[model samples]
Structure formats: structure tokens, C-alpha cells
Target: MARFRSICNTLEVLFFLIFSAWSLGNRGSEAKDTLLAGEKLRDGENLVSAHKLFEVKFINLENSQNRYLAILYLFGYDGRAVWIANRDNPLMDSSGVLSINRKGNLVLTSGKGNSTIINSEEPAMGGNTSATILDSGNLILRDGERILWQSSDYLSDYTLYLQNDTTLGTETTREKGRQLLDFGHSAKRKLWLQITVLVLIIMSAFLIAFIICRLKSRYCDSGGNNEKNEENDTASSRLQLNKFSDIEAAYKNNNASEQKLCGNKDSELPLFSFSSIESATNNFSTTNKLGEGGFGPVYKGKLVGGQEIAVKRLSKMSRQGLEQFKNEFTLICKLQHRNLVRLLGCCIEGDELILIYEYMPNKGLDSFLFDPMKRALLDWRTRVSIIEGIAQGLLYLHKYSRLKIIHRDLKTSNVLLDCDMNPKISDFGTARVFGQNESQANTSRIIGTFGYMSPEYAMDGLFSEKSDVFSFGVMMLEIVSGRKNNGFYQTDSDLNLLGYAWDLRNQEKILELMDSTLVDSCSTNEFEFIRYVHVGFLCVQQSAADRPTMSEVVSMLSNETTSLPSPKQPAFTIGKSNIGVESSLSTGQESVNDVTISVMNGR
Candidate 1:
């Protein structure tokens, strides 16, 4: 009897210990709605809203190893993240903790001893401040009614919020109120019982129907079933044929109206449906239209998921035809560089031909460089960065890219700026690729902006990498001087910008050419500014052979120690009158507001 009692006691002790551990674990897993000062929320723990609509915790994104603290929707299985605390600085491990430090600021501390204060600007409220996750997916820090910080004010990702209609005496609110009121113990038991009975009845009816169908199918007459099967197959075949014919009709329409699809050769590039594009751009409303270019009208659009995009639609009246559209799509899709604009996809349906690209918030370089009010924004450092970025992009096209491409039309308007003011080269409609050993090509059809065209290309139809260098040099001069090349002429002399810059260099008054707005920044970086002008002069030399290669230009701009050779007089600097007469007689085309010329014959 004593041995049996001891055995029972041991078993009871074991059961008690197991139950205590299980209870502790369950409590730990339960999410809290508030985080007070001096309390830490570890990696595996979460702060859930009172209504269970949203959750805040550390999460590892799909296919990414880094962990981030994010607020996510809890109603959906996907748990889409609405906001992230540390998006750019993610924790490499799971050992991350969220807490309000002694200073009453929300801080994220990693196991590696690095800490990030989320609300650094908020004044310390001692132990009175508390962080709470609201049902509206907003995380707020408050002391009583006074709010210190809130997540809704800072939008990092997609927009998400509960509709106010639900709380304003709607059917949903009434139903929720009814559910909460009928929560007595006996009422709940009766409700569960009724639900169980209803579910059983539904399942039993489905099982009976399933059994009957199976029996009928197994015992049915063979001839009738065979006829039915044949009819179904015929209907399926007709459906497939109809789909194929519809595709064929679309192909024919595309070929008749505009450029045809390259037939799976460019299958890797996505083809956006016409309806989606229309919806994204709000039917291409005038408000959404960004600007018009040589290709056509461009519009700003937002996808269904709140992703912004720029749509380049080819206008029916545009001079750029099938060749230019196809050229831009094919070349830009293959070329990848940091300084180049990204092509997302294209659209070709009926007479509609559109190209989708990553939206640039700051638009083109000319918008800031030419606008008097905005010119001050481009400080000396920013101008230098843009110059270097343009040079790097040209070097990539000329030597580093898979194809040796010569951008026939390089101008300020073709350079886009991102939100960070980084320059990206765009518009590949007039670019041409060359063979590995080929250095230059001749074309009677000269297509490029007027003032940017090189002397050889304009006079003799000979174009090479040197021609693009010449265009870049012109742009460089314009960026520094804040004057349009074709419009600006010396007061006393009829010399254009190029000739004026040459005279300034000779007289050692190069600073006179600097933009008035850049005076403050130019004071400290005067030498760097003069070096850029010297390099620009070297690029626009009269002889193509005298111009430095794009690679050499990059080296000179990057390495200050590199020696630069003296530049000869650039072409088209022999007074505007003589050069204009010669150019008109040779190409038979007069310069117009620096517009792109599609067709010009060489002499």
C-alpha cells in the first residue's frame, strides 16, 4: 500500500509540472495591445490590436533572410505588411527586441548591441508614455490624451484603413452589437449546440447527394453517357478554337495598324493588357497626363496595389513610326545600367502602342537646370554628379554594354531625375548598335536634335561614338553656363554658346560662364568646375579624332591626377552667320528650337 501511494504521488507531481509549463507557454504566446515603459517585446511576441484587425511584430519577409519590425493586417491569411519600422536597416537575426527605453522613446534593439530609436524627436515623458497598437492599424505613443507619435503620419508602404461606415450605425455594426450582447454562458452553449447541429445536417446532406451521384454514374447506360461525353469534348474544342481565332485577330489588327509583336522573341518582356493600363491611368485623364514628347504623350499612373508607373503612349500624329518604337523597346529592355531609365513593360493592342517605365518623380534635368526659380536647387555638387552620371552612362553604351550603342540623340531633356536627384539616361529611339570591330557608320538619314549634332554627322553623314561625345559636351556647357546653346549668342559677336565658351577659356574668364545661381557653391569647388569646362571643350573639338573617347573622359573626370591635353577650336564656332549658311547649304535643314529632326540628307 505504501509503494502504490508513493507511485501515485510521483505521477501527480509530474502532471502538475507539465500543466504549469503549458500554461506559462500559452500566456507567453498571447499578444498584448499595449507596450509600457521598461517592458520588452521579444522576437516571438506580438502586439495585437483590441479588435484583432492588425498585429505588430518582427517578421521575415518572403524569400528574404533579413527580419523587420512591421505592422500587418491580421484578417487576411497573407498578412500583408502595411508599414515597416526598419525597412532600410533590417536585423540579420531573429534576436530583436522592441521596447520603450528609460527615455520614453520606442527603440528597436538587436542582439548585436545596435539600437534604433524610432521616435527620436519626441520629448521624454518618463514612465507615463505608453505605446498602443490601434484597431485602425496605427501604432501610437501617447501619455493620456496627448499623442507624441503615430504611424499613420508616416506612410512607407500601401494604404490600408477600416471604413468609418462600419462604426456609424451600419448593418455590420448592428450585427456585431447583437453578437456581443448574446454572450451569456447558457446562451453561448445553446448557440454552439445549434451551430453543431446545423453543420452536421449540411454535411450529411452533401454526403447523401455525393453517394447518389456516384451510384448513378456507375450504373448509368453506357451509350447515353458516351454521347454526352462526346458533346462536351466538342464544346471544349470549339471554345479553344474561338480563343485562338481571337488571338489571331488581335495579331492581324496589330500588324495592320502598327508594329507587330516580335513573335515570342521578346517573350521575357511583359505585355500589359489595355484595360489594366486604362484603369491605372484613369482613362488617361488630362490630370494624369505628365507631358508630351517626341514619342507621344506620357502620363503618371498608379497600379491597383498603389505602385506608381509612367506610361508612354505613342500618339497617332507622332513622327516616330514602327522602327523607332521597336528600336526603343528592344534596346532598352536588354540594356541594364544604374544611370539608365528602367523599362517595365509594353502594350500593343489594336492601334494602341504604349511603353511603361519606372516613374521619375523629379522629371527631366532641363526642368531644374533651365527654370530660373529651380536653377538654384542644382548646386555645384549636384551638377557635378549629373555630369559624372551622364558620362558613366555614355561609357556604358559605348564600351561596357553587351552591344556597342551610339546614342544619336543625347540632350538634357532626355536625362531623367529620380527622387534622390540621380540622373538616368532615357530615350533610345534613335540609338544604333555597332559590330564588335565597327567604330563608325554612315547614314543619310540624320535623326537628332539640331544644336547637338556633330559636324561630321551633320555635313557628311558620318556618325560614330565621337558624335555622342560632341552632344554631351554641348550639354555640359549648357549645364555650367545656364544658357541654351542655340538661343544664346555673344552680345558684340554673333558667336553662339560654343564660340563664347572658347573665348572665355582663352581669356581665362571661365568663371564668367558659370551660372549666377551656382555662385555660392562654385566658390569652394572652382577648380573642379574649370576642369569640367576643359573636358567639355576637349569633347567638342573641330576634328572628331581630336575628341577624347568616352572612357578617357570618364577617367579624366574621376581621377584628378590625370593630365588633360589642350583643346582645339570646336566646330560651328566660326560665327553663327557663316556656320548657319554652310549647314543650310550642306544638309538643307535649318535649326529650329532644338527639335529632333527625323529626316535630313547629307551633302
Candidate 2:
């Protein structure tokens, strides 16, 4: 009888293993909870939380060609995005693919090779990592019991941010709402507007070109008559022409841009030849292109000595100007920190301008943090380290740098990751400096990514060091939840992330807002995590006067037992919705940008 039982047990175990393998292999992309290395979750492939509470899948934005990976309610056509893998840089088409690369990072790559790194701010867990969608609706990347990254940190147990009344300057909500209109702007009227805009652009282009030619005629031959002087003059003239052409070509038709680049290139940094860069990047082949941005394309290259580098190349007609380029180059060159991206060298020849840096194997932070499969790999401790690293980098920029600078654009995409998962702040295009006595400043032209913009800066164009604090607060919430503020919307309220957090705080259910995945996985101080949320709330208070400085934030985060202050209401909360929806299973489609709530003025 004992021999018969043993044989039966062995047969059962083998059958179970065989069945599990078959289920996984044939399951395709549906109803999957875990993903091992070398597996893929292609576009339209999705999964639901164990209790059927939430769903994760790829979706195209309403009325827009771009695609995004979204997390929504289980078994529902009622579309809402809790987290997006590629928010700032949405995929151009629907050929989205979610997979674990050899580095063990979760990546969303298009069929055309455009890839978004989802959980990259953390170190890669190698091939041993497995991505799992948890019962708590948290996507975690883990290596056995060791957590490497998780999506919960991006929006930890949170809803998407409510976007209602985003105004351009003092424009009323109705006026500002016009920009959010994806359709209904009469086709004929739009066509007429397009033609009118085209005419204006052409006329403006002619005027600018004519003015540039006059300036070239004036500066190209200013002095000297002898043969040697003439030769020297010609060479100098060529160099000047090259500078002008590169700067002008690099920027849109902006005044005094070429002069800014010429003036800012003070010879402190090495200038590599275009040929060397061309060789390094295989002549900027399409395959060599790593990514694209508002400025231009970035390419991965290897120097002759075998040093891997990333080159930021400016398109001939890029909208980024010489001033922005010079600011980033000069600022980064002058600043040095482990928390900041290193600048190796640069190239400016003719109509081509390129900035080179040490290659980062991990890529951008958003790649990993927002990816469902890879987020669990971050764990809690690694995430805290990243938060501190970002704060330190910001501290360096705000206080320690030679010039007190404000990083106007501080978002997940701008924070890069090294091979070891260290956080480095990059992209200083919109950074502004201040004198020792200067405390605050304002600009008519507001520049920043949508989701991370501070209340004051986004609304009134007023920015100080505190402006960065507000952005940090929003980012802190995102890190805690793994969600994007711009995409978070509620049919019930205009509360956005801040308002919802305020409610949670008021209700003393703040823990409910934390990444439920971390509730059990994190072995570190639970108080510390809660305290970070408190600090975030304090930072994002409605009034800038109520927010703490970065120094205070650092201190608070570092010392858990420090005394804390109660947070006030957050800015831009219009109110909640009174209307009711039928059900989550309702088959009717809703626009992603549909606005049902009201608005307010002051931040």
C-alpha cells in the first residue's frame, strides 16, 4: 500500500508541473499573473488582478494617434488610466510591446523600435527577475523574495490625477478648456486656421532669413586686408558662419539665438569633431537612434577607446534654441555630482550640434517605475534611495551649484538611471539662475511637462525654489503610487491627486493610499514611508508659504522622528462631480480627456 501511494504522489506532482507549463505557454497574454524572463505581453494583451478588481493593458489615447499602457478597472470598457508607462513620450502607433529585456528591466517597445524604459531608476535584477501582477493590483518586479521595482511606488494604491481646469496664463477655465478640445473644432475652420498659420510661418521665415543674411554680411568680414589676414579672416568667417548656421538651424526663428551660443561657448568644455561623433554613432543610422525628444535625437555610441557614450543630436530645424542648449551644457559642465548626469564633451559644426555623455545602461526612470512587470523589482529601500538621490541632485542645483538654479522641468522622464540604479537629474533646457539675493521670479513663457508642473508655475508662471518643491511633492505621490498626475481623473470629483490625498489624510486612511505591495514587502520603517507621504502633502499645500524648503524636506525624510506639521488643502481642486455613472461594465466608451467637473482660479 505504501509503494502504491508513493507512485500516485509522484504522478500527481508531474501532472501538476506539466499542466502549469501548458497553461502558461498557451495562455497567450490573457489572464496572466506572472511573467518570467524572455516572455512578452504584446499590445492588447492584458491581465486582471486576482480578485478581478483592476485591469492592465495597452490603449490608444482618444482622438490622438499615440498609445499608452494603462491600468483600469477589471472587465470594463469604462476607460481610465491609473498608470501610464510612456506619458511624456507616448508611442506613435499601436504596435506596443511589453517585455523583460536581458537586463531584467521591463520595457515597452514599439514595433518600429521606439522603446520606453518603465522601471529604470532602479538597478536591473539581471535575468533572474520575474514580473508579477499582484492581488493588490500592483505590478512588481522581483528576484525571488528580493523586490527590485514595483508600479505601486509610481502611484501606490492611488487613482489617476484629476485634470480639469488647466489654464494658459490668466485665461478663464472656459478659454483654457479650448486647448483640451480634441475634436468639434469645425474641420473647415481648422483648415482655414492651418492655412493662415502656414502663411504667417512662411512670411516670418522669410523675414528672419533676410535679417540673418544681413547680419552675416555685416560680421563675416569685419577687419584685415593682407593675404595672411585675409586667410585668417576667411577661416574665422567660416567658423562664425558655422556657428550661426548651427545655432539658427538648431532653433526655431528666435532672435539673438546664434549670438547666445557664440557667447556661451567659452572654451571650458572640449569640442569634438562631427566626424568622430559620426563614426561613433555609425553615421546616426536609424537603428543607432536610442530616443527622440523636443530637442532632437539621442544615439548610443562607442568611442574608439571603447567608452560607451550617448550623443544628443540637434535636428537642423529643431525647436530648441542655442540659449537652451548653452544653458544645459554650461550648467551641467559647471556642476559635478553623482546625482547629476556627467557631460563628456560636445560638438558644434555647421548645422549640426551634439552633446555627449556617459551611456546609461538603465535609461530613464519612468521606464521601470510605471511598467507593471518591472516595478516590483524596486522594493521599498531602493525606492527611498532614489528619492533621496533626486532630492540631493535638486539641492545641488538649488543651493550648491555655482549659480542657484531652478530645474523648471523636473519629472520622471528627466531623471536618468545608471547601471547600478543611481538617480541622475538631466535636461536643463528650462533651468533658470538666480542671484544670491534673488528669491523668486516670473516668466510669461511657461515651460515644463504637464504632469509635474507646480501649481504656481503652471498657473501664474511664478517660479522660485519653492516651485520645485511643489513638483517634488507631486512626484513623491507618484513614486508612492506609480501613477501620473496628469492622467489621474475622477468622475466624482475635480480633486486631482492632491485633493484625494488630502481626503485620505483627513480620514486618517493615508495608509490606504500607500502602495499596498510595500505594506507587506518592505522590511524598513513603516513610519518612514508614511512620514514621506506627510512631507509630500506638506510640500504640495495650496499656498507656497505653507510648503517646506528642500533642505527641510531632506531633513524630514532622513530623520523619521522629527516633528511634523499638519498639511492644508492642495491647490487647483475645483470640487467633486454630482452626476452618477451606470456601472463599470457599461459598454459605452468615454473620452480620455472628457471633463465633467468644474474649476477654480488661484493655486
Candidate 3:
């Protein structure tokens, strides 16, 4: 009996030791909740939320071999993907990895070695950065407690269905209750039917009220004064006749221009009634006004369906007349590019002329580029992106688009930013279309921001693709230096931003022209910084022939191996004498002469 008891004790001890070892091994190999810097989440591996509600891993869609890094729900839905990292550029094979790079960017690399930065704005470097899949199904990259990027901010097309009870058993039970489910579905159908009937009844009531109001007005007109009503009717008929005549003439001209350019009869531009615009803008409320440009006051408006828009109303006192309005309407209707602002429709009633566009929430690039506080938000990466976007936009206009267009008013204020900080070139009122063989054109009326105009265009009224290149270069310098070219005079040398950049380049101290806020963000990428400045110099060369074309500019920006040619001295490097003359004129005023010039100041 004593030997048997001893044997039992030994077996119990051995079992306890084996169980402890097994638990330790499982704990070490279990799925992690966060991915740290330098640690990669491989194709087969995943990071799960704390409560195991969400998971982030590599996935392939149905019947598609291409793989994507996505965040998905873990329970009740069998891993339905909520957000995808590389939706547009999916991996060809299953070999994929996601990690936080040294620069604090969340990057996804595919089997072919292509990388995509998931973060919109590169986070500032510091601390141990990590990525976590939250219980809310949001994949977030964080530096300690501060979130550097979140998947919620950038939603995908996939809809996420949230459930109060997230359990497999509950889902199974619900699935089994088919009769109850059918009854609930029937209840919903009945509810919808009732709502539809209610809506119809309400609509009928409105129609009846409208008819009664019309009858009342007619009865009053019949009883009050027949002779007065006749005179009023005659005057109203004449006014309407003139209005219709003007509209018909405008339509005919626009149709002819559209036929010559687009040749698509079905691509008709929508015409909004003036009353609808007034209602959208709340009768042009002072609070709804965005700002007054050279043309007129712009207002922020929302349509009945919750679509936000920007309404550009032409002022009677504006220097831009009917010809300019018509020119803008006809030209913009035919041109379509991702970088160009989208014109929703237009309104022409009586003397009122308005153009409606998709509202840009972030407003103009100048609003952020020149603002002291907002400029800091635009780091080196974002500025480079903006520069590249604008370059592509110009390249499309100068080469790729159906109709070659010259954005005569390319300035900081004319470049608008979307919610994602993507740059869209706006203000096509001064833009001109170029023929297939036409290289340059001369115009007596010079309409553009003073600092942005090229020397050839400013002096001899000769404008071409090179002229736009000059303007782009000036803008590049401004974007890099975070300073406006116009009205920017150095106290000592009386030099503007352009001349200062040139003088710095001569001294081989061009890095000093960089924005102070960019120092930390671009410390490791000094070569890229200098390269951009060099390209800016190349674009702003004095001679139009010396400047690179938009295509070459884009190539130089995109390809690192493309060698750039030496740039000559830039034009209009105004000194103290010139500054005095420029300062004397009122800002935002047109030159009162045969050579009409609209001067735009830095706002």
C-alpha cells in the first residue's frame, strides 16, 4: 500500500510539470494585439483586438488571386473586411507584409517589392510607434497614446455592420429561428408601405395648397384692376422675352463651342434655375459668403439632397464682363480632369449669372500655405505630394487633356485643396484653349496675379507653355520657402522671394531658403529638398525657351535619374525701385489702360 501511494504522488507531480510547460509555450506563441516598429505582420499572421472582436491580416477577395491587407470583424460575420490598405494596388500573390518604417510611416509591401504609404500625413518621429486593431474595427497606428493614423478617417467602400451581441452561438440561434425572422421582415415591409402612403398623402396636400394659392392670386388679379393687370402682364411678357432671348443666344453659342470641342451631343451641362440657387445660398446670406474674388462674391451653399456646392456669383461692378463669364462657362464644361475643379451646373436668370462647383472643404492652398499656424501642418511629404499633384495637373492641361488649356491664373489662391489635402487647380476664368499647332499667343488684356506672371507674358504679352512653367516655378519656390512672391521685399537687399532664392543659389546656400518648419521633417532628405529647389529654378528661367516644358518638369520630379539642365537667371527680380512702384498701386486693382492687367495680392 505504501509503494502504490508513492507511485500515485510521482504521477501527479509529473502531470503538473507537463501542464505548466504547455501553458507557457502556448502563451509565447499566441496571437499578438499590437504590431511594434520593426516587427512585421506577415501574410499568414494577424493582429487581433483585445476582446478578439477585430483582426488585421492579409486577405484575397472571392475568385481573385490578388491579395490585400485589410481589417476585418472576427466574430458573428466570418471575417468581413471593413478597410483595405492597398485596394487600388493589390498584391499579385499571397506574399505581403505590413510594418511601421523608421520614418514613422505605416507601409505595406507586396511580394513584387512595391510599397504604399497608408498614412496621409507622415507622422513626426519620436517614441515607439505601433499599430493596433481596435474593438471598433479601426486599425490605428500610434506613437505611444497619440494616434498618428486611423483607418476610420479613410473609409473604404465596404460597409461595416456592427452588432450588439457578437457571438457565434447567438448568430446560429437567430438563423435557426426562420419563422420569427420572416415575421420581422414582414413587419418591416408593412412599415415601409405605411411610410410610402404617408409620403404620398403629404405630397398631395402640398399640391392642393399650391393650386389654392394660384387660384387665390388669379381671383384677386381678376377682381382688383383689369387695366393694371394688363399693363403688368405686357411688361412681364417683354421682360421674359428678353430673358429667354439672352438665354437662347448663350445656349446656341455654347452648343457651337461644345460641338467644335467635345462633339458629344449627349454631354449637356445642367442648367440650374436662379430661384434654386437663391434658395441654396439662403438669398446670398452674408454668412454664406466665402470671399470676394476679382470676378465676384463666392458663397457656400447646400442643395436639397445635402450636396455642398460653391456658388460664384458675378458682380455687376466687376471688371470681368459677360464675355469673360461665357468664356469660363464654355471652356470649363468641356474640360474634365481629376485635378481640375468639377463644375456642377450654372444659373443664368435675368441679370444674375452664377456658376456652381463641387465645394472644397479645405478651401484654397493659400489658406494653409501662407497661414502662420496652418503652414506647419503641411510637412515635407505633403508639400512634395502637392507639388507632384500640381505638376501632373499642369501636365494634363498642357499635354494629356482633349483640349490643350493654359491656366493663365495659376497662383496659390487658385489652387484649392480637398478634404484629403489633394490639390485641385481652380479659377479657370482666365484660362485659354490652345490649338493643336499653336505654341504661343499674345493678349492685350493680361489677367493674372502679378508675381505669378512670366516675363514674356508680363512684358510683351506673349504667353505660352513656358510662361505657365515660370508661374509654376514661382509657386514651387513659394511652397518650399512658405513665403509669397508678391509684396515680399527683403529690408536689406530689397529683393523679393524669387530674387532671394536666386541669390541663395549663387552663394550655394539655397537650403536657407527652405521653410523653417520643414527642417526637422526633411533633415534626412536634404538632397531631395535641394533637387526640388533646382527644378524650381529651372522652371523660372528668364528665357521662355530655357524653361522646361510641363512634361519634362513632371519627369524631372518623378524620376530621380533624370539629369536636369542648368537654369539661367530668372526674370522680374524687382528691387527697391520696382518695389516702390508696385507698392504704390492698390492691391487687387486692374490697370486702367488699353493693356488691362488684373493684379492679385497675397491674401
Q: What TM-score would every model get versus the actual structure?
A: 0.56, 0.53, 0.58
Clashing pairs in 3: none
Which tens-of-lDDT digit does each residue in 1-603 have in candidate 1? 222222333344334433432332244324588998878889989998754657899998767989999888664325767668888789999999998876667889998885755764657543487888865567887653335677754211111111123353356655554554454445646745775575566556556665665565555545475557645665765654443343333333332211111111112356789999999999999999988766778899998889899999987766564456767776776466789898877787656778899999999998999999998999989999999999999998997664689999999988999999999999898899986569889998888876788989877789999999999999999999888776677779988899999998889999999999999988988898999999999999989999999989999999988999999998878555865534554444332333667677876
For each candidate, what is the lDDT?
A: 0.74, 0.65, 0.73
Candidate 3's error at 266, in angstroms? 6.0
TM-score of 3: 0.58
Regions of candidate 3 where Cα sits further than 4 Å from its true position? 1-250, 253-267, 319-321, 579-588, 591-596, 599-603
As a whole number from 0 to 100, the lDDT of residue 562 in candidate 1 is 91
Which stretch of 10 consecutive residues in model 1 shows the poorest summed lDDT? 257-266
Which candidate number maximizes TM-score?
3
The TM-score between candidate 2 and the true structure equals 0.53
True-structure RMSD, every candidate: 19.5, 29.0, 22.0
Ranking, TM-score, top scorer first: 3, 1, 2
| Per-residue lDDT of candidate 2, residues 498-577 (tens digit) | 66777888898877777655766654566777888888888888788899989898999888678999888766443333
Backbone clashes, each candidate? 0, 36, 0
